[model samples]
Target: MLRYQVVESFLSINGEGKRAGQLAVFLRFAGCNLKCSYCDTMWANQPDVAYTWMTKEEIYEIVRQSGAKNVTITGGEPLLQKGMKELLAFLAEDESLTIEIETNGSVDLTPYLSISDRVVMTMDYKLPGSGMEDRMNLSNLKKLRTVDTVKFVSGSREDLIRAVQIMEEYTLRGRCACYLSPVFGRIEPVEMVEFMKERQLTGVNLQIQMHKVIWDPEMKGV
Candidate 1:
């Protein structure tokens, strides 16, 4: 049986991207390659990752338990798991489920492209302040489609500058749906809007954590 760090499994609203507030089953896998300063899921960082190893049949039972029509494979970095392909292949048997993955954009995601017709990939594009900018593969940005959304968590005006530069260089503002999110309570959403207006950026949206409003900002799940 393949081992996987099943960090957390629960039902909740997506809270981000184009599908905000949609009910879904979130399978937060454990382990990450990038150590971004503002990572909300930093509790996943460990000296030795811990996980619940399960066979594909066992995995199906868990999703079957969730009673959710949508499923999101998130991480510490779900792509880090080699068995992720197997998981997706198994899940694809459920014809009614809409599967999506939230990736940090540091990995080659080609293998996952075939899993679902509605794979809403949400890419977290690390900025200068995230301390992992160099790890980003520029080619992936070009491959990202309109169905995919890119999220940028801005911590400062300098971070915004770097984000805008990357957007322009790749024509990201026009190519796909882009999201500008202020680190919760750090940068102001109003400030983000003004900056976007000043730059005349198109396809850029301001995203807020919707679950934060319904539940406590510190609350883990619904």
Candidate 2:
């Protein structure tokens, strides 16, 4: 009875964040609570976007067929789905599988706390460039553990400054893995690295979108 709206499910390397370059099965869900200007997956954000309804068992079957031990449950915002907690609980039973939940950091994560050990929450903390920073659930930052990551997408020097401020304010680096990634085409990855070095911001990593570099930036379903 619990069916989820799915935009697509395919095998692809994680393009960004800490899991970049890892082969994983991506389960892209439909719908989101916030809209960002530079969202690459805008197709999945539309309220009327056509999607297939799949239950947790159906999704798990696809993952099993993919032959990938790792799975990333991503979306326009996965937490918005009513049965996401149930889906995650089902996936967590596979002790050999590594699951990652890519969230927009605007929804409550408390429901998934019990399975935190099995699922890594790669939370995106929207900056000014995204226009959705105000919508971020800052409380989620406190819930992160070493296995999880808090990411900040910077498009300009000002964005980087704000990210650093939030990092210190939250003591994020000490709390969990912190990453600073540049918004593609807006800020150069080297620029972000230089800024991090100048600030001597230890424990924070600078990452680029690896999948974009490996394939055409516009290609889908890789």
Candidate 3:
């Protein structure tokens, strides 16, 4: 039996992504490959972080009972988990649930792409501020489908500029949904908007973490 190191599981509205503000069952797996400077879930990635080892069936039960149609498999980097493909395959058996994977761009997405069309992805392109930019797998950019989303979390003006360059270089605007999000307190939303307007970054959406606005930013399982 393949067991997952699950840090936490809860029912909360997706704070970001294409399904932002919609109710979802979040399954946050433990551990990560890259350490971003502004990582809000550092607690979940610590070496001593407490976690429950769960099988695919157990995880499915949690999602099934949540009564949420949308399911988010987030992390400290969800794709790093062993047997993730099996877990996703098991989850996809439930036709009613809309599944989404929130992956840090370092992981190769090609393996997961064939799992199921139901398994849409919301991948991050770690910006310069994250300190994990070089670890990103650039090949993943071409693998994104129309239903997928590529998110750039910017913490500074330089990061924002690099994000635009990557967007244009990959022609991400029309290939998939492109989003620009401010790293919680690092940069102002208006600043990002101004940059977007100046660049005429059409088709790119600017988003803030809605859950942070609704509840305390540091609050867990929200």
Best by lDDT: 3
C-alpha lDDT of all candidate models, in order = 0.81, 0.88, 0.94
State each model's C-alpha RMSD to the native. 1.8, 1.0, 0.7
Candidate 1 collision pairs = none
After TM-score superposition, the amount by which residue 136's alpha carbon in candidate 1 deviates from its true location, in angstroms, is 1.1
- The best-first sequence of candidates by lDDT reads 3, 2, 1
Q: lDDT tens string, model 1, 1-222?
A: 676778778888888887788988888787889899888777765646566766668767778898888888888888898788888878888888777888999998787776666766788999988888899977888877767878888988888888888888888876678998888777888888889899887768888888877888777645
> How high a TM-score does candidate 2 get?
0.97
Per-candidate TM-score against the hidden true structure:
0.92, 0.97, 0.98
Looking at candidate 2, the ten consecutive residues that score lowest on lDDT are 12-21
Each prediction's number of clashing residue pairs:
0, 0, 0
Name the regions of candidate 2 deviating beyond 4 angstroms: none
Residue by residue across 46-75, what tens digits does model 2's lDDT show? 879989999999999999999888899988
Order of quality (TM-score): 3, 2, 1
The residue-by-residue lDDT of candidate 3 on 120-184, one tens digit each, is: 99999999999999999999998998989999999999999999999989989999999999999
Best by TM-score: 3
